[model samples]
Target: MHQNTRQRLINNFPRSSAQHLPNTSNANGSSNLRRVGYIEYDMSRMLGESVKTFVYVGYVVEKSLESIVDKKKVAVKKIVCGSAEDCQKNLQEVKILLNCDEHENIVKYYKTETDQDFNVYIAMELCLGTLQQWMEGNIPTIQPENVNPVQLLKQTTKGVAYLHGKRDAIIHRDLKPDNILLKLVGGKVCVKIADFGISRVLPHERTSLTIKTYSGTRGWKSPEILNAHSSPPGNLRAHPRMTRATDIFSLGCVFYYVLSGGRHPFDQNGNSPNPELRDPNILRDRKNTKIEHFSPRIGGYIRLLEQMIDKAPQQRPSAAEILSSPLFWGHDKELNFLVHISNLMQENKSPVIQWCKNQIEEDHSNNEDEFLPGLELNNVGWMNRTCEALDFYFMYESPRTYDEFLTKDLIRAIRNMGTHYETLSPSVKASVGSLPGKFMAFWNNRFPFLVQTVWNVCKVLITDPDFDSVLMFYQTG
Candidate 1:
């Protein structure tokens, strides 16, 4: 670590003093070193990113003598400073930790320890694992109790908001999923932002800062940072200029990663025709291509992501602006839930559709009406949700009609609902009937089962004199 940077870190804890503790250990290799308020333990081998800092898993004991002993698992980062660069990086992380208050979305920083070598050990609250590892293991799905990517992203945004709202706004140059760690909160996994090694603190009054030092992961780095270089033949490139918006771009990449189940938004994969984008390094191509292809599951959040990773920094919303976005406030849960269910339904239709029918049956009473109450589409919010769900179903599973996905029981349920078209609300009649034509028009082939069902409903509904508007929509829509 640089002398000045080390001094700044020391300044943050002026009253603190370090005491050398004996490295006494048991047969299992757990340490018995105890401080006034902390009990240090033997850490496991180093893990995490290949940076100068080393992170290990350990536990800390607090208030041992007070008879209120509490042992907490923690991630201890040991920085054996070998150069000025290492010092600055560690110091930067420590500074951000000191400046920010404890937030649920942000990793909790305990205290820093220095050995005789002046090496710094930063102790922090440990988590279950990194978001990257979690995603790799669990993957993305809309299972009822599974971890929702939407909720994880919300937690990440809140952490960023906390950083940006501080007196000295902190810019996390690297905001990839790897830097996001998770904790089981109230039986639900919550995301917490960590690893501020490359983060920078900007003056609160300053809207922008000219940072020539280029830092961040290759594929996840912002365009401005990559393009800031001025090439000189046979010489190393210059550092890039950066702003707070850099993090937003990287976040968009994270969002894309989560949405596509580990696929890069800009890179070519099974869906891409252009072979060039299939290369390992996609940072250069990301700015060149428009993100036209993504998982249809993420279609709802695509617009928000576009704004987040906009080429022009000024065009992207700030952390505070993102919090107020309608995307966060409205129908996201229901929409995301439906999107997940639809994804499963499209992938393996028969079982998922059967599961949906079973769930509807299990949840509702045998009142024999409104098996799927939301399908009535009386609520405008629910109408939009159902429309999108049906649209996604038809658009993705084209040529394979509902006959393959829907079981006999589900089809009977629809037919039973169709029998009472004359007694149905005008809105319900129009909404239910409109789905068939929309599906047929989109797929360019009328689905027989759906058509027959809606046709039967229309036959009964048309008898009502007030069904004129509903009849027109049912036939022409």
Candidate 2:
């Protein structure tokens, strides 16, 4: 052990637990001695494993002569270095963590310790799991109902922006979902960037450096890094000059995975026209591929991804640019409103009847032109969709009470259909004449309670003069 390490143990440790108890002369010429090694904890539970290390969840006692440590959990990363050269490289990673101050999105660093036997242990705040694991469990389709892609994209971009905006910008060479740690905060999940082992800090100047060592995970490396060796004979110096654009490409892949619910954006498996979905290392002269057959609903996000993973690195947007893009903020407002309707129905029963009615009126007032057709109801395509929603709600719901009918959005949709029907010319209205039996056959067959909800929604059409004639004929029949 070095002399400094020996002193550190002597100064920091309790006198009673020291392996070598130092003797000293007191003021009265009496001898005083101190022993060390009081702090103790077991690094037994294995949390995770990496290329050169094993992370264990453990706790340590501090400022106590007793060997008992509190039960608060901490992740202990044990890095095994066989040679001094390997040890120095590992220490550089620790220095980077130390330099980065507290950031909510970046993994929290606690402290570092080294043993005389050349084992290094770094303790950090514990997280539940990784973003990769979460994705594996919650698979999303093109029309995502359960997952919120907007929230995921916003949080991920925030982390990248912080890293790139630093004085000496840091590029996370391995920015896969697996490196993102997830923690539950106030019933919502948040992500933190972890595993900075292969990260690189760019110099203040934009000058390129020739890095011989390859870094990054498969399917996420940028085109420049993948085609580094394919440069022209005179351009040997261009092979390893990686820039911030590399990270942008990887981030694009991440966004694809989240938005597609776990499908690889570059995946050409199935009917997609892109070549192969495999790693870039295998294809030396690989052609640049584009995202194919993505859903039109997520087109905004897909457009941003296209710009991010562009073949030319210069064309890719910076992290800040991506954060400010319209794609990041764009989400279907109607879909969100439907989600709110679903939640309002599920959480309460008594107040939801009035709530649903108020929401429908508010939505119509806010988007009057959207629900109202230009001339007539039957002239627009939404007439069929409104009828479909009515049919679906009536067929699926087995509500015991009228207030519990699962037709909130559908009710609003049908009301818009009714309003449009009232505006048609008498000649046009006479062409399609039936009223009561046509729209409410399935609804009327329901139990008494269920029939009331549908009756309340259709009552609005009684104000129409032609509809009153049709209703009088139906009521007398």
RMSD of 1: 15.1
Model 2, span 1-477: residue lDDT tens? 354754464346221222322222231242321111221224445767877788776543344357543444567677887765666567666655654525677888765655544556666777877777777763232123444666766777788888888887788778888888777666566668877777788877864455555666777787676666466546667665787888888888788777665766566542342324545522442323332334433532344676787767788888887765434432232223233334434454544346546544343223223222231123232223333443343345323222322245444433333335565445434433334333332222221111222232333444555335324312210
Give the Cα lDDT of each candidate. Answer: 0.55, 0.53
Off by over 4 Å in 2: 1-44, 64-71, 138-147, 229-236, 270-277, 281-295, 330-477
Q: Candidate 1: misplaced stretches above 4 Å? A: 1-20, 23-41, 45-49, 63-70, 83-89, 138-145, 229-240, 270-297, 329-477
User: Could you tell me how far off, in angstroms, the CA of residue 112 lies in candidate 2 after the best superposition?
Assistant: 1.1
Taking all chains together, the TM-score of candidate 1 against the true structure is: 0.61
Report RMSD (Å) for each prediction in the order shown.
15.1, 16.9
Q: Could you tell me the lDDT of residue 283 within candidate 2?
A: 43
What does the lDDT read for residue 6 in candidate 2?
A: 43
**All candidates' TM-scores?**
0.61, 0.57
Query: With candidate 1 superimposed using the best TM-score fit, by how many Å does residue 371's alpha carbon deviate from the native?
Result: 34
